[model samples]
Target: MAPPVVPEAIARDYNEGAFVLDRSPRASAALARRCLEQVLEGYLSATGSDLKKQIDSVKEKVPENVYRGLHGLRTIGNFSVHLNKDTNTGQIVDVEPEEAEWTLEVLDLLFDFLFVAPARAQERIDGVNSKLKASGKPLIE
Candidate 1:
């Protein structure tokens, strides 16, 4: 049997974002935004909802702090996208490296909260239930 897998879309975007971080912060930020979007979409879908097509959906789906973090990620990415475009028109608005980097940091926290911690908790629950069944104890509800 195949091992269980966490979704890879966010991870892929994070990798690409990190890869471009030094050279083009704007591109990196864009990928970070993609990661955040995919994570939110996954959360919404897990709750039997369809994909969250708008940025505001994060606010609706998550707690305030998580929503804020996601919003921050989006804001940085938006700045990068808009500023880069402005550069083409002789308007140079810059996205610092730190701004792009912060998105990845926030993503790490979200991944743990949204994916890793839950998976671990579920595994622990399954193990406890298995032991209870083997011992003739009533399983947890």
Candidate 2:
């Protein structure tokens, strides 16, 4: 199974974002933002009524870089939601060059920090403990 942090539904959202990135960067960015919020809400139990507040709630718990990335994704996603069109001209305004792509990159980093690293560390510990059990030695606590 995939990592528990990103359930299948969330992954699907992220993939859908990637699939439509070229045609509609704003849409892609919106999806990325949704996925990030889901991860924060579902896994971290991030508390707050809105994305910005939720991110602020978790700020002290995560490293500076991770916190910055979360805010970055939030900012970019806000652009997708709030700034996608010209209010006066009624014309679509595309995301800044590579801005949509950067959201995806930030998600990858968040996933690595919150999920993959912990799971891999547990796997290594289990492997070593199994050997210790076989040899009648105490397991690593």
Candidate 3:
């Protein structure tokens, strides 16, 4: 599969606002959830393991606090998919913008660490050296 494109707009929003600032919280949350789903699916596909089992294993492998944080993110993502609605008004009552931004930020970091950084770190370092040599910009130094 082709690599995922990190959303430039979201990065810009994060850089400018110190967080993701798009107002569509539900959409952002859904996107973050989708990213997590993709990662889990990829992991399962590679390892031929069930996602739930893998998550359980991960919980055992990680520290309690870290596992709790992951569990909380997973819960937020799951609830963002299944809950957060008013039956009468047909409005979403629980999905918060801050929560969505936070989820997205965490997902971005996870993706960068797990997928992008390992794949591109060497290339980026070389590119930085090349650019520095060409322009004397001291990109690394």
| TM-score between model 2 and native | 0.85
The full ranking of all candidates by TM-score, starting with the best, is 2, 1, 3
On TM-score, the stronger of 1 and 2 is 2
* Clash pairs, model 3 backbone: none
Q: Give the alpha-carbon lDDT of every model.
A: 0.72, 0.84, 0.56
Candidate 1 lDDT over 50-113, as tens digits, reads 3233546555655677667777887787777664446467767667899989888877767777
Candidate 1 lDDT for residue 84: 46
Lowest summed lDDT across 10 adjacent residues in model 3 is found at: 12-21
Q: Give TM per candidate.
A: 0.75, 0.85, 0.52
Report the backbone clash tally of model 1: 0
lDDT of 1 at 86: 67
Question: Can you write out model 3's per-residue Cα lDDT over 11-124, one digit (the tens) per residue?
Answer: 443343332336666555655655555655554232226434545555544445544554555666665667666789988666677777677556555556555776698778
* Model 2 alpha-carbon miss at residue 100, Å: 0.7
